[model samples]
Target: MSTLPAYVVFGEALTDFIRQSDGRWAAQPGGACWNVACVGVRLGVAAGYAGSVSNDLFGDALYMLAAEAGLDMRFTQRFDAPPLLAMVPSTQPPEYFFIGEGSADLRFDPDRLPVGWRSAAQILHFGCISLAREPLASKLVEVALAAHLAGKRIAFDPNWRNLMTHAAYRDTFHVMAGITDYLKVSDEDLQHLFPGINQREAIAHLRALAPFAQIMVTRGAAGMSLFCDGIEYTQPAFPVTVADTVGCGDAAMGGWMASLLRQPDAAPATHLRFAAATAALVATRTGAYAPCWEEVSSLLAQQITESPHAQ
Candidate 1:
């Protein structure tokens, strides 16, 4: 089998506090880039995660989960502080509460980046809370700019959270956008970050900001749209009985990256179809669980049967 392209996902990895029926809580390994890395590895992609973790139990669990998911762990750091935690409210629209103060994830230092790590990666994916903090955010910016100068493909998912209202976060958003090659943002994210801006206006604004970048906007349930190479193509999301919406977007990102890395010259429509299908399937399950390739293949087949022109 041909070796898949290497992917480096840099950001925070934390425990997600999920609500249970008994009014209790269950902790699961999560974080946007972490989910993407897991799903990418499960999809047969060579993936690595770069970030810091506390030397606590939660951090150890994350390390174990990353190994089990087949993610390369050479660059992960463990510190003496506590691990970051995110409390996710169980509702139709999820709400996030971050609880990380002087935690390990925020202590990531770019100087400690693994030796020869960037040499193996074809793409570097980063965003979310990673871009909202200090030291780490500045370090990520340095790496991203260096990668861009090296002509490597860069994938960015703003994954904007409410905390972005902070000046540092907003500033990083614009700074990162300039160096991104592929940009993904949710409809809600766009509105939250740039309120009073319509989709068309947002697209135009982003295009002007990063003229060479391909922009993708995902609308939950409705589907996603791609604006690239001076054209727009949209793919409707697959129909599925959603058990939980967690990890669905990350699944989409992973699937999209997998397809693009495998078929660099494929049409944007084909990319969107694969991503949307994978995301829909993920929504049918709970937590950060990812469907196997066979499951995605079955869904793709069904999608084609339902809409012959999907690709």
Candidate 2:
């Protein structure tokens, strides 16, 4: 068995402060890239999240969670700065703002990562507000380019957040899109990234920007569509009694990327179904829940057996 990670995600790892209906705050270790790395590792891929976090209690919780979930911890770094945080004042409208100015996540130092990690990483995933912030954003972009030049697969999800301005994120998006092998975006993300444009035009814009990338556009509850090799494969969302969708996008991205790496020759529908099942399972749990390989496979198996097309 190799010690190398098949999937390496770069971005911020922060604590999410969700306000409860009772006027209290609850803290959860969450970040888009962290969630993706956790999901991938949980789903049986050798994965790691490369970033910096504060050497405080918040960062301690994130570090412990990553270790518990089997993430390659060599890629994690701790800084003596303030911990990054996502303050969520409301959940109904999905309102959030980050508090990480000069914080630890922004101080990510790639040079500190384990030596030879660049070459050992088979697929490098990048996205979220990490790409929209300064210092960290520029560093991550260079890292992505280095990974691309090394002939490694690139998986990106803009995972657009409210903090991103179209001007800043648009430039980063174009740069990453050009090198991305697998790109995931939500309909909501497209709305924010390409506002003043309709959904069709938005996707068209993405296709034009990332001509060779397999773009996965997810429409919650309505399902997802894949634009691959100039063909479109649409699949309905895997239904599950709803819980929290916070981790669905990460689960979907992790699932699809894992499928692609595991079975490079699998059909698009097969990949989409696997990804959707993984995400659906996450939606049935609270927080950024990561499903193991057995759980994802079991859900997929049950769905297949229930499908009308089952032979």
Candidate 3:
């Protein structure tokens, strides 16, 4: 049998220091790109990650987790710096305070990208702080643009963290949007990128920016919306007990990409349903934990069985 197409995720690999309700902290290996890669590999896609991975304890933990999850680490850039750290409060809308100045993620050198890495994967996913921070931001854009020119599918998620200015992120958004084939963004991201505008206007703004890309927007509990082939498909969020929404958006992105890899010609609604279901399952757990294929399949099956359309 032919080997499955590989998916390459390029961005940050860092540790998040999540503050617990008991005034304690727990370290979790997470970065938006890393989480997306984890979700893809966990969902049965052959995936690899390319980013600056430090040689510190947190970095070691991130590497082990990725390796255990079966992610390809051949493209990861090893650095002597420490891993980036984010202090996240346990709240409904999680807030972040970054403690990474000269962290490995920020110091990523795009020129050192693995030879033939661009053609090694069918799809290249990029986003998060790697596109929001300096030096690396430009480097990542250069890499993404190069990959696009090489005819590889490009996926992007604006993520829109608090660490970067709205203007900075907006600028990066435009740059990536031009080359992105698939765009996964959040309602909050739209609000930050195009503030004082209604949902219609916000979407219009995105359309104007990336008219060719299939755009997916996650709207918290309301669910998700997709703009593809000049048509709009909306899916309501799956009802699940919320633990925290820290990784819900990334999970949605991962699920959408996984579906694309498994079923490239699936309908927009079908993709939206799968992605929304994946996000709902992820929201049931804390942190950016990647759900296995069985977990997502079980939830999707239950949804189909419970839906009135099925009857």
Candidate 4:
């Protein structure tokens, strides 16, 4: 069997401090792009991560984790600064407080892109806080536009956080959306981006902005909907025990990307089943934990048996 095509994931890898019930804090390796890349590698895809990190211990841990996850670390750059940290309150839904100013992740320069990286990757996936920031945001847009012109697929998950309602970040959001080939957003994201607009209207509005892009809107627990090739697909979220929702969506994105890479002509139902199952499995785990290939394969097989359209 031929090896699957590789994917290049661009963005940050930082530690998240989640407030515990015991009046303490626990730190875990996170960053959406990092989780997605790790999950991709676990699912048997050759994945590469491109970004910068601080010389601190937390950053070193992220580097080691990426290496252990089988991701190519050749494009990663390091600096003497401390890694960015996010403080998650116990009551709210994953709120982040970026600690470092001009952190290493934002120091990426387009000229430093690894040799032949752009041409070698089948898909370039990026998103989350990286798209809402300054120097990094501009750099990412440059890289994405270059990749698109080179004929590589661009997968974007706005992963729009509620904190990005500011004027500057909102403008960058639209700019990034314009260059995407595949986009994933949540129902909350739709309303946040376009206040007072109905779901259908938001879809139409986004479609008009990126006419050539295929869009997927995830409605937590309820289901997810995908608009592609002049058609729409709505699939229910898999029923499973919830632990923490941190990496669930990233797992789904990895599954969808993996399926598309393997079977580019697969039906919408196939994509949804694979994505929803992977997401469900991830939700049962803690903090950005990625599922192995065996786990995803089992889920896919079970889904096929349970869903008549999962062929």
Using lDDT, give the best candidate's number. Answer: 2
Better of 1 and 4 by lDDT: 1
Please list all clashing residue pairs in model 3, or write none if there are none.
none
Candidates in descending lDDT order: 2, 3, 1, 4
lDDT of 3 by residue, 77-193 (tens): 778986788887855466777777888887776667556666668998998888877878888888888888889999999888775675776678888998889998888888887
lDDT of each: 0.82, 0.88, 0.83, 0.80
User: Each model's TM-score, in the order given?
Assistant: 0.93, 0.96, 0.93, 0.92
As a whole number from 0 to 100, the lDDT of residue 260 in candidate 3 is 88
Better of 3 and 4 by lDDT: 3
User: Least accurate stretch of 10 residues (summed lDDT) in model 3?
Assistant: 302-311
Per-residue lDDT over 1-311 for candidate 4, one digit per residue giving the tens place of the 0 to 100 score: 12333698888788888888897999988888888988888887888778888888888888999889888777677877768887877535555577758787888766775667776789899898887777788888888888888888899988777558788887777776887888888888788888898988998999988788888878879878778788887787777788878788888888888778777798877777777778888988877778886897786666534442321
Candidate 3 Cα errors over 4 Å, as ranges: 1-5, 166-168, 305-311
Error of 4 at 282 (Å): 0.3
What is the C-alpha lDDT profile of model 1 across 19-40, one tens digit per residue? 7778898999889988888888
Q: List the residue pairs that clash in candidate 4.
A: none
Summarize candidate 2's per-residue lDDT along 172-204 as a digit string, tens digits: 889999999999999999998888999999999
Name the TM-score of candidate 4.
Answer: 0.92
